[model samples]
Target: MKTRTWAPYALIAPTLVLMAVFLVYPIASVGWFSLRHHTVTQPWKNGFIGFENFRRMLFEDQLFWQSLVFSAKWVVVEVGLQLVLGLVLALIVNETFVGRGLARSLVFSPWAVSGVLTTGIWILLYNPSTGIFQQLAQWGIGDAGTSVLGNPETVFPATVVTELWRGVPFFAILLLADLQSIPKDLYEAASVDGAGRWRTFVSITLPHLRDAIVLSTLLRAVWEFNNVDLIYTLTGGGPANQTTTLPLYVARKAVDSHDFGYGSALTMAGFVILLFFSILYLRLSKFGSRA
Candidate 1:
């Protein structure tokens, strides 16, 4: 009995050790640093003041709240769009048709694209002079203004669209899996009762997909909240603070300003907010133990 229990631990020991070194240790260090004030002006000489960094960030920094709000809105739109578009694609792919396998591969091909590549491609498309949109703008149909990502009016929504291009593919694939997992017999039974496609989807398909949908939504929300790469590469959160989300703000504080402690405090705050969103998703999902 002891050997059996120990065997499982032995197999996962490396993974646990890696998590401790890479994940847990860094998180704990960030917590420790966030409580102190470390500035480049003082360099090595530093003094600790508990909660001061957090207090300053929470109350005094207006950008913090703005970033939080912008990021919240971004997630709301991104997750919603992902769900709608992904579900549509999954439903289409689930149909019994020839060449569906190839069709699915084509649809999900974008998921293999790197985040950096996606941002870069979108930036090119947003370029004023030679971009696809710019050409369309000349014809009076598309946005012909300055850099789409650089426009205060357009930046947030524009970036969200770019993000969607990458995100929807993954969402579609996951939803497709969930859609395939649903048994065909359920639909047959529903049809026998004179139920239509919409009724069967509502009664049978959606119930089976609830768990996958919850998992995908929560994962996407968390990752999107932490997304610095896409925003940083796309517009650098300009033409003003319009596109600046929490991650970008934290990056500016840490890397650009070289205020480690303040940035760490910002990171802590972000972690707390994301954690709350996660807990709320869990509560809403009715996720019980996998019995």
Candidate 2:
């Protein structure tokens, strides 16, 4: 009888155990390390420094604050563009069109490619002498495409371009699913009632897609916040820290500088920011409904 009563808990025991072993332990260790000093000079010995790391991150270190701001900007621009462009592309492919399959396949293929590869491709494309973008700029679209990565001003935006390349496909596939699920009858009824295309889209399509829109925004925001590989490969937070984001900052501090305590604190800070915003978004969207 006791065994039967605990059966569900027993089934979940492995998951709990794994969490403790992997997630919980590492996080706790990291938190502990963050409150102390660790470096290659004194690898084993750690001196507890209280909240000094956080203090430095908040006040003294301009780099930390700058990286945080840069990350926020990246999130705003990249995710905003992805949401708009992805939805537009999804809408385009949702209609009856020639070569729909080919269009979707091409649009979504970028997502299948890894972020590192995408970054590498963009790096090549941004090469001053041999880049296609540079070559095309001479033809028409202004000199805006000239070795974008090499330019300090364009480095951040240029890095964001790579992220968009790898991420747009995800949004397209998700939004396409939402679009397909909208009943054909709704469109037909709207047509019968003389509702114009734009009106029908505003009234029926957008309303029905609220959940998907919210979900996509939330997912993309989190992914952008936690991103490392995209920026790491594309710019190395480079062209004089123009492309530095929080994740890259954490990697540089911990891995490169071996300032484990500061780095761990930074990582924890990023994680908390990511987690808090995600929770806040879910709560607001879930309960603060339009209805």
Candidate 3:
């Protein structure tokens, strides 16, 4: 019995060691850095400073609050839309139809694309002079130079749509996997009971998908909140910092300003916010609870 227990731990020892070295160590380093006055630009000022970074972030930085608010909005909007759209796509693809295999492959292709590539693709598509909009304008649809990314009014929506294009595929793939695992017997039973499609879906399909939906949404929310690549590459949080997220702000702090300590503080703040939101969301949704 002891050998059996020890064997499992021995097998997993390398994995645990790697996690401690890579994940735990980085997180601990960031936490420690957050308490210090460390900036690459000003090496002389690099020293221990307790809670000073947090105080400045909380009380002095308006951009921090702005980025936090945008991060919240970005997560909520992106995750919600991705969930709804992905569920719809999954349901559609789950149904028997011609070219279903091809359709699934095509739809899921976007998820395989890297964030930087997606950003690049969308940048070309959104370019005012040579993009789809310009082509449409040539067809006498609208103005010839409608700068979506440049305009503050349209930038947010445009960015959201661009992200949705790439993000929806991920949710669809996950939800579709879960959908496939659902037994057909439930549907047949519901059909025999004269349950309409809507009723059957409500009573059977949704209940079965509850855990998957909750978990997927939670993960997607966290990803969207921390998502910097697409937004950074596409918008660079430009047009007056309208699309700046917390992660993007941290990136700027670290890269642009060389404020590693303050960046670490921001990173810690993000961790806390995500942790709180995840706990609250899971609790409220009663995730993993029996129906």
Candidate 4:
């Protein structure tokens, strides 16, 4: 009885310690740093300054607001498009057909690729002088020497397309897994009761996928909001910072400027905004209530 009581705690102790060391400690440190003057380059000015960083970030920083707006736009467009395309892709692969295994593998291969590699491949493809566009131009399809990344007018869409290549696979794989778990009996019953494809999908499939869609979208939104690797390497938040998200801005502040205090404040702001939205979304969507 005594061992049983302590066994659970003992089993979880290592995980609890790891979480404290990695997650809790870092979050606490960031919170503490957010309220201080902790710039690495200016050690002479290092001291506690309550809410000064937040004050400057919330009211005085134009880049912060700009990055926040871009982050919102980026998340909305990326997640919305990925969800739709992923659902379609998942549905296609879920159906019984010749080469289904090969098709599913090919569809999911992009998600297996690392962000750095994906960015590298896209960069090579986007090269103005020696890329797909140049090839098309040589074939008399479009103009030559088209710099998609360099052009402010096209950079946003280019980045979106590039990210969609990698992101859509994630949603597809996740949704596909959930889709397979759906009982076949429901579909058979719906079909026998005179339900057509679209009607059956609307009545049975969508509802069954509700929790997965909500959870996946929320997780992907949080991830995309924090995503800096691909965007950093691909665009470096360039074309006049048009592609810069909030996380990218924070990276610039903390890394480029060594303004740890300000960066911490920005991180805190992101955390609050993300938490609020996540809660609101789960509540509004009534997540997990269906299944």
Judging by TM-score against the true structure, name the best candidate: 4
lDDT per residue (tens digit) for residues 262-290 in model 1: 99999998888888988887777666654
Instruction: Write candidate 3's Cα lDDT for 220-258 as tens digits.
Output: 888898898899899999889889999999998888999
What would the TM-score be for candidate 2 when compared with the true structure? 0.89
Which candidate model has the greater TM-score, 2 or 4? 4
| lDDT of every model, 2 decimals | 0.85, 0.85, 0.91, 0.92
* Candidate 1: regions farther than 4 A off: 1-5, 40-45, 137-143, 280-288
Q: Estimate the overall C-alpha local distance difference test score of candidate 4.
A: 0.92
Candidate 3, pairs of clashing residues: none
Residue 235 error for model 2, in Å? 1.0
The candidate scoring highest on lDDT is: 4
| Whole-model lDDT, model 1 | 0.85
lDDT order, best first, reads 4, 3, 1, 2
Count of clashes in candidate 3: 0
lDDT of 3 at 279: 91
lDDT of 4 by residue, 1-291 (tens): 446577899999999999999999999999999999988888999999999999999899999999999999999999999999999999999999999999888889999887789999998999987989999888999787569999999999999999999999989999999999999999899889989999989998999899889888988998999899989889999989889999999888877999999999999999998888789677857767977
User: What range of 10 consecutive residues in model 1 has the weakest lDDT sum?
Assistant: 282-291
lDDT measured at residue 120 in model 4 versus the true structure, 0 to 100: 95
- List ranges where model 4 is wrong by over 4 Å: 1-4, 278-291
Residue 32, model 2: lDDT of: 92
Worst-scoring 10-residue span by lDDT in model 4: 1-10
Point out the higher-scoring one by TM-score: 2 or 3.
Answer: 3
Query: lDDT of candidate 3?
Result: 0.91
